[model samples]
Target chain A: MDSQITLSVNGTSRSLTVDSRTTLLDALRERLGVTEVKKGCDHGQCGSCTVLLDGRRELACLALAVARDGVEVVTADGLAHDGLHAVQQAFLDHDGYQCGYCTPGQVCSAVGMLEEVKDGHPSHVTTDLEADVELTDDEVRERMSGNLCRCGAYAGILAAVRQAAGA
Target chain B: MRALDYLRPESPAAAVAALVSNPNAKYLGGGTNLVDHLKLGIVSPDELVDISRLPLDDIQEYDDGGGPGLRVGANVRNSDLAAHPVVRSSFPLVARALLSGASGQIRNQATTAGNLLQRTRCVYFQDATTPCNKRVPGSGCSAREGYGRYNAILGASDACVATHPSDLAVALAALDATVVLLGPDGERRLPLAELHRLPGDLPNLDTTLGRSELITGIEIPFSPVAALSTYRKVRDRASYAFALVSVAAAVHLEHGAVRDVRIAWGGVAHKPWRAERAERALVGQQLEPDVIGAAVEEELENAASGDENAYKVTLVRNTTVHTLLQLAEGHR
Candidate 1:
């Protein structure tokens, strides 16, 4: 069955006919020509399709395009057009990427992670609830464990998130 | 790659209507498991019904605040349920088990009902080409003699050996939880202990759930047994891995004697096994080293293990005793 969805991509909004089964990742790349939403595992494992759904990081591959009809999807490219978001700048400064495959997801997830911290959402390592958010190495590790880096860019990603979070 | 039909039912009645008529329909919550299965072609639903909008997100009262525990909705996220004030105070075992479960992303996307109702993650079941009794009953279990070190021990038949993958269910079974079901007929609830069945007779049907029924909530009755409750998982890795042998144990001490004791093991059975015989053996007996050891030993006397799974017997035993003793000591 065909369903029409209107998604606000970056700044503009577009309406398109999409299959109910088509994932946001597929819709972004296939229909909208937004290739920035990479399809890594396509099963929510690799986190390559990480995007900000209404300003919160979510795996686009795991989300149905039909379910995201009215939601705003902010991808990695949404953060910066020419260069990068502050987090991405920190990543570039920290040499946070190797093959650059998982970098976009990492940056997008970090951007979300920082917001989560700012919103007082605690992680497993956030033992003291009364204290301000601490983006320690362990904190970043625990928070960013969702996105896997096959190229072993964890140290760089950690630095990137740490710098962005002002740890 | 298929264009599927989509329906968003705003109410539970509407959701049931969508489920009743469309045999090819799937009720989606969080889409953590179903979407992955859809991509893998393990389950092909021509119609996708979004049940996430239903009013099943609240955590209600279950066994009263004094004794019996709380009721969690099917739409409750694992992350939220784990961090809920009542959950964190009343049943840390559930929270601990959940926190140790899938990655934060998956947990945020996974719902309690979906997690409890999730099928086994056996490789064969995931691979459509492979033989899986759970996937296609009577097709034969490919993991019986295959890479089955992680399959199951108790209540597992030769037909199937897949284990229930929910970590919270183990703790819930130990706490004497109940599964509330809502269907076309009406709402009915089952003691969580009765939710799962042994794979001996019908390896296909894992739970006692009806086709049109939805697991509305899990009601955990509070018991003093788990004042020192804990979940110990021995997995392939420290994090982001399924357990090889895990034990959720609860013990109540009265006059320094083992009172109402409950034990359940995940990754060790087709269902979350409540060790009744073992619990009986432990009760009325002093929490002594020998008494506890003997009880644990008696439980595994009939435990059948293959070449690679024999270690699970020892692991379950040691882990059980250690958890019981630790909780027991906490009282002192």
Candidate 2:
């Protein structure tokens, strides 16, 4: 059941042998010693394990490491590689987290969400599907609904996302 | 979770062949639902045939001299399907349903076929300790007498009352979508409405899919009504929660009268309950509150509900009426 796989974490390449049941979140955190991606619910329900996989937002806890061979994974820490990402900077400025446990997920989700907005991805609240998408407050809230902050930092998170999107 | 073997097949044929040989194996899609089931000990498959990498992720336009339509690959992620230009423009209901179902992260990881095949989110079915007939054959359904807030209101049997949880399925059902499958014998197509099964005496079987049958894609024939459709989900919270009652409606009005309409209700049935009777009643009729109400009532005539979930009957009716009225207003 153990299979060897390679993952590009941040800018570094990591090779590890993981079990078939080893989720991407566990592979990144336990096997590769990359703990920036936290495991909150371990189920897809909580977005605490959200990460950018190949530039798309995905829940790490629900994905198997073996299934994602050679995929590039960018965590919240990866966003601050050279310097703090605009989203991370915005979060800090806006006080996006009372407790930092869910901050990583919130940051990663926001980054991916902004990219989606740029790509004209429509959310549930979007009324005009034909028009270009704007990073409105409702859009941000709907796009980031997967990630939950127990500290009730949604207000700050929303503000940070808007500021980062330059809305 | 128990350790399991993983096999990444080169093609759909190879995938089906691999599964045909192992009766204790499952086709791994996005792993959003199956992995959670693995962690919960709800299922124990010995092998996972990884079909995520199969060349079945494209959303293509096709016409077999029948009519213009779309063929959505089974491996297409929910988010990608939702954001696809064709899906958004030609089938906005699908996009809306996909967005209404899960969080952005979950949708990005969930596949179209996987969303259809996902097990019920009934609290009892999720708890391995609880006696769920759907999870284990003849184990006895705990939801029948337990917290029935999310249980079925229609097409339920004595054995089970768990409602189907896919918002996309409800939309597909309303749009008269068809499922394309590649089985051990050969490729075959089935109507989307017939894919899911009502839990009768045998609650373990969720779908009519044969063993070793791989869902290759879904076929949605283009329609003017479908182009003017929408999905509305009513849940406990605004997002990330399953529907309490949802409606996918497509209304085509002609000169202030209903020319055609398709209606499907979720969170109130074992499967996506296509409101054929409601559609029958609404066709050629004016889109008025009384007319919509009467049509919805006709559809709910056979709808039976438990004590805790009785509200779903009225909720689904109101939701259907509200959704249809909105669509009718848009048409004007």
Candidate 3:
């Protein structure tokens, strides 16, 4: 059976009929033709399907489409309204991606990562409980470890995140 | 994947009622683990009760007559739970263990209950074509005679040798946390230790949770030991990997002697292996290398290991002793 789901994507609401087995990844790519959300591994291992749901970054491939009815989804393509997001511009300025296959996911994850840092959410590397977590190299690397790059462009990625974070 | 039915239940009672009515129904939390299994044809539930919408995502501190305890909702994301101020201050071991598991993105999708009910990471069990007792009862155990370097060495039966792949469970077991479940009848509480069953013979069953039961939250009591706790994980990489052998240790030292202690190990057993024997041996004893060494030896006396997994025994011993020493050092 197919169910109708209304998804608030990038400030736009889209209603579509999808099967219960369809994941948010499938819905964005197959149903709505938003193919920017990569399907790497198709499993939950890779971070290629990362997206922001109500401002929280999550794996789109693992989230069921029906379960995400009426939630805001911000993918890499939707990150920038007019110009490129600061993180995206920083990626270009620093050559944060090589093959660019994983750039979209990395950008979305970094967007959400910055939001977490702004909200005072600490990472595993943050040792001092009394002080605010700084976006150091270790913290950025630990926070962005989910989005892996096959091209090994982590050095540039680190530079881009640091620039965008203004560290 | 099979065509599935989805039910969005707004209330916990409705969720349990939906599961109670359907014989083949599963509660979908964050879908980090279950969706993977569903895609691999590991499980095909006739109906999935979407409990993610329920309003159970609060982390609160309450005084239940005994002391100040924390109750974390089952739907609370792993990242949020780990970053909560109370959890970081009261149970840093839990926060560290949670952060050590999965990746930043996966933690955003994974929930508290899903982490506790995570399936084994054994390749045999994941590959549907292979024969695994935990995946298919009475089929056979493939890891027993196969490549089992990541398999269990403690509390493993011949039928199954797969380890529980949750670092959070190991810390929860050490904290003496209690799980709150809501069933068709009513709500009930069970200790996290008794929640996960050992693979004695029935490897098919994983937990003691009833078929229609929905996990509401977990309650962790306040203790001075948790303030001095730490989690040490030995893995293949620095992040995004299951533990090879990890230790979650909490201690209360008085005048340089171990007054109270708690220890739990992961990646070496069917369930979170609680080192009660070791804890008993260390209580009222000086924090010395020889004393911890003797306790580790006594705790691992009945451990049975396979050919490739014998290293886990030594790995577990070293990790446990190291964690104890670190906690003891912090005490001083």
Which regions in candidate 2 have their CA more than 4 angstroms from the true location? none
Clash pairs, candidate 3, are: none
- What TM-score would every model get versus the actual structure? 0.91, 0.99, 0.98
lDDT of candidate 1 over B10-121, digit per residue (tens): 7887788788998878788888888888878788878888988678889876555446567788899887787676665567577667866776667767889888877788
If the candidates were sorted by their TM-score against the true structure, best first, what order would they fall in? 2, 3, 1
lDDT of 3 by residue, B172-270 (tens): 999999999999889999999998888988988889999999899999998999998878899998778899999999999999999999999999898
Comparing to the true complex, what docking class would candidate 2 get? high
Indicate the worst ten consecutive residues by lDDT in candidate 2 chain A. A128-137
List of chain A TM-scores, every candidate: 0.95, 0.98, 0.97
lDDT of 2 by residue, A1-167 (tens): 89999999997999999889899998898888889899998988879999999999999999999999999999999998578899999999999999899999999999999998898889989987777997778888889999999999999999999999998
- Report the Cα lDDT for residue B236, model 1: 80
Preferred candidate (DockQ higher): 1 or 3: 3
lDDT of each: 0.80, 0.92, 0.90
- What candidate 1 gets wrong by more than 4 Å, as runs, is A80-86, A114-136, B1-3, B62-68, B254-256, B284-290, B329-332
lDDT per residue (tens digit) for residues A1-167 in model 3: 68999998888999999899999999999999988999899888879899999998889999999999898999988989789999999999999999998899999999999999998887777775436888889999999989889899999999999999998
In model 2, the Cα lDDT at residue B171 comes to 96
